[model samples]
Target: MAPISAIALLSFSLLSISISLILSSNIIEDLNLPPPPDFRSTILKNCKENPLIRYCNAVSGDISDVFKSTIVAQHLCNESKNPNCSNSFTKIDLSTRPLIAPLYLSFTFFWKYCPLTILTIDLSNNSLKGSFPSDILFCSQIQSLDLSYNGLIGEIPTDGFTNLTNLTFLNLSYNQFGESNILRLHYFARFNSSSFLRSGLLAKDRKFNVGSIVLQVFLLIFVVGIIGCFGWRCLQRPDLLPFFLQRKHKFTQAVLKAATDGFSEGNLVGRNKRVEIYKGILRDGSEGLIEIHRGKFSFESRRDFVEECRILVQLDHKNLVQVLGWCDNREFRAVAMRWTDGYTVVEWLSRNPQWKHRLKVLMRVVEAMCYLQDQWPQVGCEIRTSSIFLSNDHEPLISKLKVQDKNNPSKNVYKFGVFLLELVSNRSPHEGFETGETGFVEWIKIHYRHHVRKVIDERMKTTVITFVQVKQAIGIGLMCTDVSNNQQPSLHQISKMIDRVYQSSLVSQSATHRHKIQRTPTNALKVNGD
Candidate 1:
């Protein structure tokens, strides 16, 4: 009797266990959960098959709340309907329960709806921290993504959304990833006008509509056609091609790396406050130089590049350094300029101490500045000593001179004259003696009133410069640098004054020679017989 009783108990226990297992499997299947195709099925199946994940159907008042509680549960509970409940989750009410870290639940759901037209995994307002999962790349059909307001860090990996080629709306803002890496994903959107996702959720005007789409398509077609036509035209009429077009250049990064020999220390050409210039050679054996402006990669940098290009193109002058073109690509941002084989005026003056050549160079620079001021009245420009360069043969030149008033209607000639003074005296406009705290112009006026020698270049001590010539130049420089803008002379007036100074110097020298001849001794005199 005892043996029979023990056998019955064993049979009952076995039957109960089998019934429980069958019910659990049925419940998991009935849940009809989705699965992420790319992630391992074992992981997905385990999460889905877990009794905790099935509690939503048993006791769910709200689906979102049930999922939230289950997500934070300690372990799978067979008896309790709310197995994953936690006190922390009770205080927080989330719009949607995004399976935060152990992402098996979300992964399964994604795979099950494998061909979903748009899979929006918006976990915003959740205050979730840590880097975004690498497995997100598996969502091949995800057309729109809103991962904003999360505490995602590190880089938005290039491979993060590599498979999400169909993506249109991508919002990863209000996060910690650096903006520099954003360009890596810029090409993901289609060329269609409607393809671009407008930034800022609140910006109603930013959204792209059907009209925008048509415009975008038209623009794309237009651009492609123009590029094709340009290439064809260049092939037909080679002479029409510019220097940059003639030489097929690589992308900015490749060119920079090759030119700098992998950015080696030896390749650094020059360093300024804003940029570092480097010498580079293109694939077609064409020599070039590039300036790497200091700024982090962002939308602002993109805008600056456009502005810089516009400025360079408009202010075209022979004396100024020519901007060949600019490059704004994903990995590199730089400006390509014509490489001038001339030393700076400072270097040239230091090497060649000849006063005559220095004077000639200074005059040439003055002439260039004066010409620019006269021609481009809209561009009130200035040429400093630093802007001047001297050729290998010690011929003076000027380059990289910028316009002071880019949008001014009337010309400012006074500023041009002040620049000439700096070039002539080898003194900065701010330096030298002032008459009444006005500046270099006032200083020049004081010197002219007193003595020319005080303001003249010391190198001209042995060389002759007439008082009249000095005074005229000083007067012109003062006129250019006058406090009142209208008091400045016109370019025509400036040209006349320069001519007068030259004539006066010649006349004064001629007079001095005649005086010397008059004072010659009678024994040394040679008589010219008629």
Candidate 2:
């Protein structure tokens, strides 16, 4: 394994070169072409400092231009309904990437970023020089790949290529890839023998040497050992793999752009200024919402979003909004969610003016908070009605939940207390307090005790059931939000307390009505006598 200093030096050395040196022992320094005219440091920086790092420079001419073309093509393709649009949209045609410079293949880059939407890649005429790209193992969605008339070298990898089950068309002509029959790809059987005829099949036949075979076997083992070491480091500190490689489900920029109309202003329904929310309709006729967090791409931002996606995928709950997938490319980055038919808590309150109707919503929201506490503890503890959605079934779901810095149970309960205050009063949290920082529990302590009725929402038509329920719900909110205690009650305990208080409140309402009916029986007695 290399030391940190060695890795740094190697990183810089790789940065200096336009592409990775091919794995051939026979070096050809004489084949070097002159650098492009009017080259600037910014051009090099685009490749070197890119989120994909130097992989862009290693592949095609004018690294920035290549990324722009691909991203724009995604937008156009997402807009086009025609299946044959690929013939008209030519920038994404990998077949023509290198007219000026030798194309160094970006196996790793394409493998990591290519969504299922991309089906074909042709680098047939480019002067690409590299070993048979083993990185195509990640490109399982690709149905066609052409790499003919290139200066590629090395024996073709058989084991890795077997993953590309969808490959129906393949061409590898006029390349320097080795004719080692022992290393022939069995997966290539999907294509006819013509695919490899003028390429590796008839290229320079290697002399048989037992020592050379032994050397190759040892080298393979050595490479595997180094990879294992890096895998171990990745476990210790997760950033090593780059771009949060664990995120498997990805939406193409084209699909997202089409769904969002290139994130048009007309489709936008909500905005916090930090993030814009747009309504989207996918190609499959399903509807969704797109949350595009405003920011340019930084390595950390990309890593964080990918991490967020990974966590969102694991969480399954009726109260939590369903995350479909994510779209990330040079053009846009966002999280896609299944659109809800219901409104925000504020809007729902206006429509459902009955006190009893709102009480039912409060109970469901409590259950969701308790679940988050039990599963992730304090990680997603922040609560507000604005962050919640009422689905068509009248269930609540959480959205845009960020990772918290500290696991403060008291703070979470305090927010829940304010959420209760909002529901009981039919007012936003901002209206309850003069300042946002002041907890709602403190406002309750200062004002509400004997005059809880004064604070209950007057807009709602009060009933016997609701009057009792509001009193009990506020009581629970106050108790849960008490930060004076050295230790706080577990969310499980708080949830049960709400359940008991609510049931008793319902019983009180039923008993109150029963007594009222019994006292009014005189009229019925007189009617019976007549």
Candidate 3:
């Protein structure tokens, strides 16, 4: 009876335990509860351990805690209603959430909540401002990550990103990332280049040293300076310029022929054995005077012709005729100059005979002579009234050069003396002297000192004329034309003496005019009344 009682007690205890277990299982099934209640506890634990999860609660001021709790309740309810409900998140798409903070995640939180391994995390267009999130390195399993169109700055964490072996697609475009080492880009070779567009993460290969950059700049400046000096020199000597650069003053035979109307007789203004001058309309519809060399020449002569033409074309001065261009051909070579429509100095003097105008014309002529002498000391230019043209404003333009007179500066001075005599006497050098006299200079010399009044032009005998100034000018001419002597002054010195004479003449004229004004009857009456 005692053994039976002990066995029965043990069996009763075992049956009670089984009943409790069955009742608990039946209650759980009837209530439609979830598999477990540890989900909420696990999330709370993760929030404590994960900085990103805590950030949500801190940024939302505990509001995110209530929201997360509500989400938990809803998830629990859904799982209770549907046994197949999933608890793992493969992707977390928080794109275009402008109020969200910069993203960060922890491995423990990610593994606990998303055990299947996170495949994508899109946080683009969030206006999230900060450096690249360092905590993203914990989510190494993420295959497609997007953080584009944000305000993220600082260098990209390339070293930490290399640990993400599972990452396949990355879109960090439109962020403000800083430059990094070029070697770091190789770690992301598997991804497309567009993934880093506008992120400022593209490493530039800055191989140029400061020294090399400075050297390149210095070379550029040196080249520019050399070119500038060449240009300046070419302005004075156009023949020295490159052939292509000289094309402005080069012309073809066909163009010149068309301009001069095939060198017709009607177009011929003057002719000589060696040269023929034609007045022609250029292609640009402007009048041009063309001088064509008539006879054929040797190679050296042609070369000399070209060299002379180039030099003549580049002689730029207001008181000189501008040679526009030149044309060279197998048949002939031609020089072109702008056609000036004005009278010779002799004709102009006949129309305007005022002493002031005459003095002005003479001074400008002297200046032009000095300029030519400076340019070609060995070549003498014949200075005479016939070789000077007067513009509408009475400005003198020296037009002719006596190429036959070479290496003779005295000849230039003699010619200038003859020109001065002609200007003052208003008589042609060819006709003024007696038939028996030596030349124009001798005729002027004989009458200039003793019979100076006779040598002066009758037209300039008015009261406005100052005889003292006239005597000074005649003296200069006489000195210049003294052929028996070889002590002729240089052209530059002659210019200075002429300038001084002009200034003194101005003073004497003013003084004489003042005396005449003081002697006037109106002035005497005013003085008597006072």
TM-score each candidate. 0.43, 0.48, 0.48
Over 4 Å off, model 2: 1-248, 437-440, 463-465, 505-530
Residue range 1-530, candidate 2, lDDT tens digits: 32222112113322333443322222223123233343334344444544343234444554433333333333333332325432332213456556422322332333443434456666677777778766655556677778888888877776666777777787887776666543244555456667765465532223323455778999999999989987765543332345656334476665666788888999998899687899999544688888887557877878777777777766667777777887665546888888888877777777754554555566776787777777866347346777777876677777756556567776777677677777776666476467652545566656567777766777766566667767777777676666677455556666776677666656776887888888886776476568
Q: Can you tell me which runs of candidate 3 are displaced by over 4 Å? A: 1-246, 261-268, 272-274, 283-286, 402-406, 432-437, 505-530
Evaluated at residue 35, the lDDT of candidate 2 is 30
lDDT of 3 by residue, 240-312 (tens): 4556675587776666777778888889998888889999987557999898885667788777767777677
- Lowest-sum lDDT 10-residue window in model 3: 5-14
Question: How far is 485's C-alpha from truth in model 3 (Å)?
Answer: 2.9
- Candidate 2: which pairs clash? none
In candidate 2, position 108 carries an lDDT of 36
**lDDT at position 302, candidate 2:** 81
Ranking by lDDT: 3, 2, 1
Best candidate (score: lDDT): 3
